[model samples]
Target: MHIQLVRHATLRVGYNGHILLVDPMLSQAGEMPATVNTPNQRPNPGVELPMSVEEVLDGVNAILITHTHMDHLDEAAVRQLPKHVPLFCQPPDREKLKNHGFEQVIVVEDDYEWEGIHFDRTGGRHGTGEIGEKMGPVSGFVLKARDGNEPTLYLTGDTIWCEEVEHALKSHQPDVVVPFAGAAQFLVGDPITMTKEDIVQLAQAAGNSQIFVAHMEVWNHCLLSRSELVEYVRANDLSDRIQIPQNGEKIEYQR
Candidate 1:
């Protein structure tokens, strides 16, 4: 399968005559407010999109929405997306998308199959107890295509280390796991997502599974640096299994 890291948590998964747009966040730089309540915010991404929102979305078949956050499922992307394209999301987010004018909305339960892919929905906690309670519920997805050569992929939406995520690793055995590892934080609370150390621990638990780390250096709340992460992984001898992609870079995987 071909996976393109669009930016932040957004990705494009291509295989079996399909291009699935996962969490399309196509807004211009600085269009939204800073996620961290701090002074001296960093500049938003100045890079131009590879293609126009309309052009990139042309002939897109479906959208996989992990959550309703603006960065993951923004108002601009939702408004620009074709109404006919089917959207797969958790039950609660389905109504939100449908109300926004998306014609086809599929509210996935624990598992579902569409076209030639099998999708498994797993629970995710945004953070530890008190932090998670404030941030609200989240989820992750494991997708397996019919083609035996294609690698099974796990997309860990915004989440922290938890039993459910570990259980998914044991059960699905994905060839590649994409985790949001920006180590994002707010003004008054602990990190609401996986930190770099968390990524290291997750990689250890995942054993040989390849990991693609995203969600860093793109927003204000996320503070971890890719260079530092690379150093940590290399020092820990995890360079072989971990990949840190730059924005708009594409990586292909086969089983």
Candidate 2:
């Protein structure tokens, strides 16, 4: 499997002869509005996509929507993606996607199979208490190769470190874990995504798996920088297990 971090939470995944576009917020820097109730208050996508829009869209067979947060599914991406492209999204966002003119928005509740690949929808807590509830529902996915030549993959959506996450790791034992480590926060509460400490905890349970993190620095709400995360990882002596990729960087794993 080849995973390319296009920008922020957006990724281009090439697995088993298919390309899945995950959380594609493909707008240019400042093309969208800023997130509500957050510091920095800057326009969305503080950084630009490392590759052009066309290059990123090329060969994309499907799209995964973790949530409808603008940072994850911006107007720009919706405009660019083919309406007929297969869209796998959480239950709540299914109708929203269809209204956006997408024809094949599939709501992945438990598990769904596409061609030969297997996708199991996993639960997540977007935040804590009221803030979390207000943030609405979110989900991650566990992708297993049909033939088992490639390693199993777990994509953790916008969620903090919690029991659900721990349980998923213990139950699935995915060889590749993609955790959103932006440490995003609103003005009223704790960070909604995994913080540096959260990543450390996840690393301990990851066994021999490699962790690839995205959703950092591109948006104003995401406070943790790659340098800061690197420092923490080094301090905790987890250099081998963690990877914080730059825009347009690709991290690949195979059996």
Candidate 3:
């Protein structure tokens, strides 16, 4: 499979003659409103898109959206995408997409199969305790290529540490796991996502699975730096197991 990190949590995964664009934040820098509720906030893409949204989406067969937050499900992407393109998302975001004119929308529950690809929908918690309750519900996706030779992959959308996440990691046994890991927080409260230490623990929990970290330095709420994260991971001897991809960079794996 070929995985392209297209800024923030957005990714373009290619496998079996198909390209699945996940959580596309296709808007230009500073074009969308802040969803994290921070003042003086601005969108920073960190790098230009590999191509225009149209160019990148030229032959995409489907779109997999985790949620409807502005950063993950931007209005610009909704407006620019072709109406006929099929959209798969969690239940809460289903009506929202239909209202936005996505005719071929599918609400994923538990697990679903498209063509030859298998998708397992796992529950996610955005944060913990009061912070988590405020952030609302989230979902993570596990994609297994049905070709029977490709590696399984899990994409952990915006989430904090939770039992369901650990369950998915252990039960699915995915070859690779891509997690949103900027250690995001707001001005008012503690962090709501994985810190560097959390990532290390997650890596250890996942055993030998390759872990790819993204969602850093593109927004103001996420304060962790890639260099600092890399240093921590290396110091913990996790450099061989975890990968920190630069914006617009691509990683390929085949099993």
The model with the greatest lDDT is 2
Query: Residue-wise lDDT of candidate 1 within 8-111, one digit each (tens)?
Result: 88888886668999888888777776665743266444244556677668668999998988878777787788888778898768778888999989888888
lDDT string, candidate 3, 1-255, tens digits: 888888888888896678988888887876655545653266555445656787667688899998877778777888887778788899888888999998899888888888888889987778777877878778999988787777889988888767878999989998998888888887666667778987898899998899989788776678789999999999999999999998878999888
| Candidate 2 lDDT trough over 10 residues, lowest sum | 31-40
Q: What's the best-to-worst order under TM-score?
A: 2, 3, 1
lDDT of 2 by residue, 144-212 (tens): 988887789999999999999998999889999999988999888899999999999999888888999
Residue 65, candidate 3: how far off, in angstroms? Answer: 0.5
TM-score of 2: 0.98
Candidate numbers, best lDDT first, in rank order: 2, 3, 1
List candidate 2 segments past 4 Å from native: none
Enumerate residue pairs that collide in model 3.
Answer: none
Clashes of each: 0, 0, 0
TM-score of each: 0.93, 0.98, 0.94
- Of candidate 1, the 10-residue stretch with the lowest lDDT total is 39-48
Against the true structure, candidate 1 has what lDDT?
0.82
Clashing pairs in 2: none
Top TM-score prediction, candidate number: 2
